[model samples]
Target: MSNTASLKKEYAERIVPALKSQFHYSSSMQVPVLKKIVINQGMGIAVADKKLIEIAINEITAITGQKAVATISRKDISNFKLRKKMPIGVMVTLRHEKMYEFLERLVRVALPRIRDFKGIESRFDGRGSYTLGIQEQIIFPEINIDSIT
Candidate 1:
């Protein structure tokens, strides 16, 4: 087998069983289905600010109680080719029991709250991943105050 395949198989065998045990899933067959919810796309001036990223992560964690990883990619439209690096967006990966819980909350509760919101348009990124974009973060019901004391 190829090196990557071998590594993946080894990792899955070790990680899956452990995750099942840690999350008290009872059986490996009960592992929750993971869904990737992409939060933005850079067409115009998408809010790629640090504050926004923090707010998003905080809101997601608060609602889902799942830690999310946020990242920013700055637009680098130099050459005629629009192949510049842009602040893509944040990706929240929910795992184990949290995965199902988050999905339910996302579809039923969180999505409706987003203002001027439209359904996600999914497209793959060549690799085994999908991408989608949100126009604004107004959908989340999080208070964005200057100070949190």
Candidate 2:
């Protein structure tokens, strides 16, 4: 949904060299690289309105240019009346070019669109993985703003 530019180019052209020197890496190959990007959304409202999942899947597919799949519940929950295999969420895992392309749009466009956004907090899981939560999908320009209610 962005220009033809890619995050991979920026990483190789600028970030890689900077990190290579900052960490004193003997070779560029030693630098750690991203393998994939996982975008997920939990739709609790789906419990009452099954059509919401289909709409979400359409929006996510439009944004990521990939098919989104529903995530099913593993077990039943009595209080919420949740049943096993109920579609409770949606997720899409992007790899290679799509991952980098999404990252490019996320960094260059979506994040900046947040109102009053100063910066992002950096938190990496113990395994060198990171996670970030964005409350609204409207930040993405690819989604049709009018379609969301």
Considering only N, C-alpha and C atoms within 3 Å, which residue pairs clash in candidate 2?
A: none
In angstroms, the error of model 1 at 72 is 4.9
Q: Give TM per candidate.
A: 0.40, 0.93
State each model's CA lDDT, in order.
0.53, 0.89
Off by over 4 Å in 2: 1-6
Best by TM-score: 2
Give the per-residue lDDT digits (tens) of candidate 1, residues 1-149.
Answer: 54335444654688778889889988877764344543332223334343655655565566556676655545556453233454344456655456545555566666777666577666666765754444444444443434342
